[model samples]
Target: MEVQSAGKETYRAKTSKGEATRQKLLDVAEEIFGAKGYFHTSVVDITQRAGVAQGTFYVYFPGKQHIFRELVEELSHNLRREIQIAVNGAAGRKEKEIRGFAAFFDYVRKHRNLYRIVQEAEFVDPALYKWYYRRLAEGYVKGLQEAMDRGEFRRLDPEAVAYCLMGMGEFLGMRWVLWEKKDVPEEAFRAAMELIMGGLEKRD
Candidate 1:
């Protein structure tokens, strides 16, 4: 009985260690992929940086492509959630849009490497590109449609509006925040909000 109990404890300890190792691999991969584009990063690089055997990486991911996909999916989910929270917490539609932009800029600032990985993946992986933008556009459309229905804005094609607003925000963010290596000021976000609101405002 004692031997059996010892065996069970050993198994539990091994499982815990395995989980920790997997997390470490993912963390290292995020940094590497962020710094080096997805196409440029390699499995060897990941294993070396993770300080694990090459075979150990296979235990958690089939290949580098799998890891890239996983990272993109994770980032996409996080961005969606952040945008949702920002929009939901606002008192008005205009405020919500501004907050949404702010949240996205903040996220990019915190995970600039991850952002680069995402951008690289868009060129290398069409599925990932479609998945990320589709989800993002859907969220924006839902928010805009809801606001319009509530009389916060004029009625317009939600899909078109979503695409336009997101495109504008993305370009502004990439130029000012990402390319310029500057933080996204609140005033910048407010300016974006004003431009969007002006276009969508209802005429009396």
Candidate 2:
């Protein structure tokens, strides 16, 4: 699909073949950036790994920074979309949280490169790095606010709570799924949920 950059620069993949090529470049970028780290990976590295020419890289992305920014944006967007879909049709907010956390770990497992590329943004572009987390937190804040309004959760700072939850999922996913190459076990998932439920759930 055609995508416009934040600067209003258009990545016009005008044909099916062009769009495929663009996606191929991005796929290779994700792989290389995750494996080699952004600094060590060069445009030539991306092109060679993608089996595309140097000029072809320019067709989709202007330069390394621009592509890195796009990759961060894309990853941020795809993640939010996935989590939203995962939590859909849930029984309630509590169940939604459970499903959402499970979904997040599942996502991180599939996209094992998420942490490497996103964390590299701290050095590559600090603003974009913050933008990534802030964007993710926006959805979390909205959901938590809704849950509170529904009396499913206690009155608290939604944004702060969102960050707390996001932090929990980030580290848990990193340690269990990303690092260990395995799903979060059932007992551990329940323990984490109970710990969160203790504070978030409304009490008599």
Candidate 3:
């Protein structure tokens, strides 16, 4: 009983070691949730694979669903961070979009489980799934709107354009990285770029 009481004290990560343990649980949850899926995975599965005590799992996440939610949120943050970093030095909207796509492809390659986890979120938690994409679109729309204001891009509905661009990136990544386990081929990438840049380019 005393040991259980002590373990409950770790409900949230308060120290560096605690944070590491929390992150480990999240990492393990990401893998299991991506592979076995939310319904199929169990807390014990994450704990055993993570080499942590079952109580430790509860310490970080209240339940399996909490961990799954955290995983999706974390992936969203990491993907956006990578894209931002990749596009920071890009000179213009065109370069920024291209570099952003490249960054996304690289991230998907490394985190292939991304597709499974996010897609499954639609069923597991519909609102969460929508939140995931909306969070992504918010940043994209802001960037597109900025370009439109600068006359770099056509003055169109930024949100609409953002979704279309996101769809293109999503399918391209799915086809090349997730399905074929290869980089998006040069031709496909070029076609995508041309479609995006040509359509959005401001005309005289």
Worst 10 residues of 1 by lDDT: 1-10
Please give, for residues 11-128, the per-residue lDDT of candidate 2 as tens digits.
7688999989988988889989999999999999999989999998998889988878888888888889889998999988889989999889988988899999999999998888
TM-score comparison, 1 vs 3, better candidate = 3
TM-score of 2: 0.95
lDDT of 2: 0.89
* Candidate 3, 1-204: lDDT as tens digits: 101222343366779998998899989888888889889999999999989999878778878877877788889889999999999979999899889999999999999899999999899878788888989999999999999999999999999999999999999999999999999999999999999999999989
Q: Tell me the alpha-carbon RMSD of every candidate.
A: 8.4, 2.7, 5.8
TM-score per prediction, in order, is 0.84, 0.95, 0.93
Tens-digit lDDT track for model 1 on 5-100?
122222222587897887687778889988876778899999999899998888777778777776677777788898888777689887887778
Lowest lDDT sum, 10 consecutive residues, model 3, at: 1-10
Q: What count of clashes does model 2 give?
A: 0
Off by over 4 Å in 1: 1-19
Residue 186 of candidate 2: its Cα lDDT? 86
Residue 100's lDDT within candidate 3 is 98
